[model samples]
Target: MTLTTLKQRSLLGLKDLSKDEIVSLLDRAAHWEAQPVKVNPVLQGKFVANMFFENSTRTRFSFEVAEKRLGTEVLNFSAAVSSVQKGESIYDTVRTLESMGIDAGVIRLKPIGVLADLATRIKVPLINAGDGNNEHPTQALLDIYTMRKQFGELKGLTVAIIGDILHSRVARSNLWALQKLGVNVRFCAPPNMVATELDAAYISIEEALKADVIMMLRVQLERHENGMIKSAEEYREQYGLTVERAKRIAPHAIIMHPAPINRNVEIDDELVEHPQSRIFPQMENGVPVRMAVIERALG
Candidate 1:
């Protein structure tokens, strides 16, 4: 079922999707990619409002392009031009947009549970592009798509999500999606930023690294305020994936990243350019997966 007419119309987090649901979306996304051009205006004449509260280049642009590719109109909303400057609540803003007859609202905000809360107020579909450090469902979908293309299958593969886990929405979503698909999941980050409170079913990094794919995340300065990271230098010294670190993986273990890399911070530049790196393709898949998501959400 397209997500809209399905009982659940909000894409707020990965926990809401089952493994089969994700695979079905991914398989459909792959089919859409093979077409090379948009053929159907499934969402024709509909309006999708891109409501972004945080700084975004890739996520926002990708969704805008994806919506237009399917023949839907897009209304771009930047926090700068909106009533947000007047201290208006998100509820009021979304209500105003819905009153204007928007078909769907895709948001990227900086507060966890904000989309879920807002979902209760709006009748149109809602897609959480990114919400605080909570979740990025589309990013996880694209990452899984890239993995399927690179490794041939997600099941039975060992995957390690390393670095900055505490503030990473991508990491959270991937853990849910990958583990659900039966991929061996491991998480490794400096102790403070590492994942905790998750199911005890999966192996921790020190143990899981014995065999699994390794995905590196960029460590930025903003995470310092989270109290999970003290300094970037310490982060690199302890958790950075250097060439020497790459040798610890089984010879065939794949490397992936959701880019805007830190070069030498979380992953060395050489490793990022390694033969197994799927970062670029991961970015490319964002287009079609998002197109699929938008279509299913608004169709």
Candidate 2:
């Protein structure tokens, strides 16, 4: 790769990426999805590390699948089982992996700004799997990919992200990326959960239902005791997408969630697999979307 190409290797957040760069990536993801064979082997012998400092199911496994499908050698790291359990710093863990000669890394950490700091210090390309509440670029990419697949072009679509916004990296990434793609984005959350820093609209649940897409954020059930919410039942009653509320959305509109869903808490169980729900399709789309990202990093 040329020095200019090398400069584009690391993907820390969508905030810095322009509309064309993102659309090109989404196009690459579509190209990956169209291939006949599952394993392309384009990245044979390349090495990629999955360094997740936080607990994850979809993002971690999705990256693993994407890496192996491209024939990259994979190294999986978790704070729970790694030297970080013994108080080793995050930089030490990544630097240790760097010294071992990884070609690229996909990192998910809790501390804000840490990923950007690591990117400056680390030589290999680093992809942000999820960096605090700042961004989850690939997740947002898959989401936009899913929307484009359903609605053709993304322009003029209104997406109402309904749930906790303040701590949702998914919400932030989706908001920024979708807006850049000409989609109108808004939030519908309890007052405490709203992100005042974002430059988006805050709508009532009724107004939210009128949008082209209804995307719900996973409620952190543990926060019920935090006084922000009283209890699970109360939250479902006020904010959750109950079966009754699901019926109110336009027949043409679709429902979406970045899952590990709280089934009955954030959305009704039956609604999870509803015809209008793209929850699992988002998961299915994650692999190819990540393949595009991982391939970008190592190819």
Candidate 3:
């Protein structure tokens, strides 16, 4: 590979990544996934910190596992139990960690523009776990990895992302990267849940089932102000992937969710692990997809 092909220091979002760059990461993930051993010490002496200013279970744990698998020393920082709850700024918490000489940082924050700003200031490479509604690059990466594994190629595949698009960083990151790999992307959501800034097509949930991949996005109720969605039951009625809806999905198609799923809200509980579903597999694929990403940052 050329020098240009071998370089990606940080992953704040996928919006800025080229198709080849994304494929390189995916290809490397395939390499890591095939390894028989549990841990590799390629980054033995490296120190990586996972700093979360927002709440997470899957993303945080996934990154920690990926870091450990690479044999890197990890420092985990959660804002809930940290000084940030004692009136410290987000920058201060990150800067404090940097002062302690961490080699890299995996960050998830609540505000949109803060990560980009932090990227410019932080000397060590900074990987974004999730940055508000802006993007969750790694989640998108693993999602794409799962898709690639299932179908073997991404070009010309149709993907429909359903639920709270207005607050979904997963949708944006997936849209940008998937399109680069030649996937046709669409959004299906309530009017209030739609993001006006994105230029993608909007389709009814019924129409979405015809897609090659139907990705159920988590309804970020906490980010919804003024009771945008009337109720969980109501949202499920209009948009949820009910057991009835799953029957409509093309037999060859796959179901997905960035999960911490609202269960029967955006997707039915029965369908979460259905025969065509890739939900749990998505989480399994995250480790190697992330191992490729973390290795890229520290390599």
Winning model by lDDT:
2
lDDT of 3 by residue, 197-232 (tens): 997999998899999999998886654457887778
Q: Which should have the higher TM-score, number 1 or number 3?
A: 3
Best by TM-score: 2
How does model 2 fare in lDDT?
0.92
Between candidates 2 and 3, the one scoring higher on TM-score is: 2
RMSD of each: 2.6, 1.2, 2.5
User: How does each model score on TM-score?
Assistant: 0.90, 0.98, 0.96
Report lDDT (CA) for all predictions.
0.80, 0.92, 0.91
Query: What is candidate 1's lDDT per residue for 12-105, written digit by digit as tens?
Result: 7887798877988899789879986665577788999999888788889889888888889899888877789899987888889999999889
**If both were scored by TM-score, which would come out higher, candidate 1 or candidate 2?**
2
Single out the weakest 10-residue window by summed lDDT for candidate 2.
Answer: 1-10
Off by over 4 Å in 1: 1-7, 38-40, 200-211, 224-230
TM-score of 3: 0.96
